[model samples]
Target: MVDKALNDLLTLWVTIEPIGTVVLFATLSAHLPQAQRRKVALKAVFYSTIILLGSIVVGQIILSAMQIRLISLQVAGGLILFLFALQMVFDFSHERPATPEKGHDISVFPLAVPSIAGAEAIMAVVLLTDNHVYSISSQFVTACVVVCIMSVTYGLMLLAEPILRIIGKNGAAILERVTGMILAALAVELIMEAIGVQRWIN
Candidate 1:
């Protein structure tokens, strides 16, 4: 039981990538005041918690109704993650406007959906809490792990200003590219596992 919980913790940690989220939060919220930044972080966490926890509870059922296999979801998520990683590694949005558009609630769009609780993260929690593989009690444990990671992500986002101050723009850029590379590797592994290539290699 302890091993399972530990495994769940690690999987969620990697999929959630709190450090990467901190970089994103720092960059996106740089223009906002401290109070507004905190609110963005809080709202992001709130939205992420709802999305992740909801997936834990009913995600599989919805997938079943749609006849979507977990492996299919894994492959699709890997592709999406790979594309997003490419954007990060290449800094595709480097030429975009410095300021986010007015009336845009970033907390809901990029920050909440794809940054903090991304496609990979959503698929991961659902896989971890598979009804056939995990008991209700075990699923509850996984949900707790999700909340724990989200809490850590929120704390890191709260300290984004200080972290960015220490790291500076150059450091953040370097870290983002490095993280993109790591995420790309993980995405490949997810795809391989879903397609059973990993088992063949092993």
Candidate 2:
């Protein structure tokens, strides 16, 4: 059943990347105490669930109706992702993560936007509605798969607290930089494909 779920939402699961969820959770909750950590995690996850479900329902239709081409969407999404990557790279600090930081809230911004329902996630969902790629029933299953993945995300955040103690803030910051590098590469790939310099490898 786990395999089946993965198969159904394979594209999205890959783009969403549970590891990325861990990074976002760790980064955003860096400044919170143990008690407030749970509340913040719940809030982020709840916001993430809303965005995921909303995107699944209306994202493709809106994109198609707006006459937005896939290439255009890719370029746009990629740029957005690049900006997000930049944010992650510079936001990490060596000091202990305590007290609320200005302009950076755990509940929104990086967590909900590019973290959970980021540009990659949105673009992949838009591409999922292909006629030959999957059947309608399969697509519906994928939507349910989206929900399951988000539920896992919620659980992962709560779990991040203890994990944070083990890894420490420095380790989490290193992970964030690595993910940023990956996202930067992904962004370059999108621009390449959009410009006809490359095509799907797989």
Candidate 3:
């Protein structure tokens, strides 16, 4: 049981990589003062924690109530992931906001919500909470894992200053594109598996 829980937690981390979120965060906080940047970074991680944990607890139910099939969700999530990844890989998108306005408030928009705890992240939470694969105890353990990941995310964001310098704007953009590609591939795999499972059940 311990081994399984650890494995699931690790898998969850890989699916929602902290480093990528850290990079995006560094990019977003580029213009703010060190103190202000730190504050924004903290808030961004806080928002991500709220969004992701919410997804873990009630996201699956919301999707069900919306009548969105898992397969469809996969395909749609794939597209979004692909776009985000494409930006990472190709280095096409502006790494930071152009003109670099001072004291801009961008913690919640692209940084925290979609970039960090985006659709793919929410999907991972829902999948992790799947009752068919994980027992009640497993679900509870996974929730604990989410809490730990949130801590990790907050810690990573706090180091946004050094992280940004280490991996410059261009480097960060490239990384995001690659992450997007991986997310796209995962999304495709998920849709395929859902189709196969539905077919078997039918």
Per-candidate clashes come to: 0, 0, 5
Look at candidate 3 and tell me the lDDT of residue 59.
Answer: 78
- By lDDT, highest first, what's the ranking? 1, 2, 3
Model 2 weakest 10-residue run by lDDT: 91-100
TM-score of every candidate relative to the true structure: 0.71, 0.71, 0.65
CA-lDDT, candidates in order: 0.82, 0.71, 0.68
Q: After superposition, how far is residue 186 of candidate 3 from its true place, in Å?
A: 11
lDDT of 2 at 22: 77
Candidate 2 per-residue C-alpha lDDT over 6-69 given as tens digits, one digit per residue, 9 for 90 to 100: 6657777787776777766775576678887888777776787777666667776776799876
Better of 1 and 3 by lDDT: 1
Q: On residues 1-202, what C-alpha lDDT tens digit does candidate 3 reach at each position? A: 6876787678778766788777666655554567877777777778878887787777778878998765675566555546655554565644455433465345775567555676666777788778778887878787788788878877887877886678775665555555556656655565556468647756
Q: Evaluate residue 65 in candidate 1 and report its C-alpha lDDT on the 0 to 100 scale.
A: 100
Which candidate comes out best when scored by lDDT?
1
Instruction: State the TM-score for model 1.
Output: 0.71
Better model by TM-score: candidate 1 vs candidate 3 = 1
Error of 1 at 71 (Å): 6.5
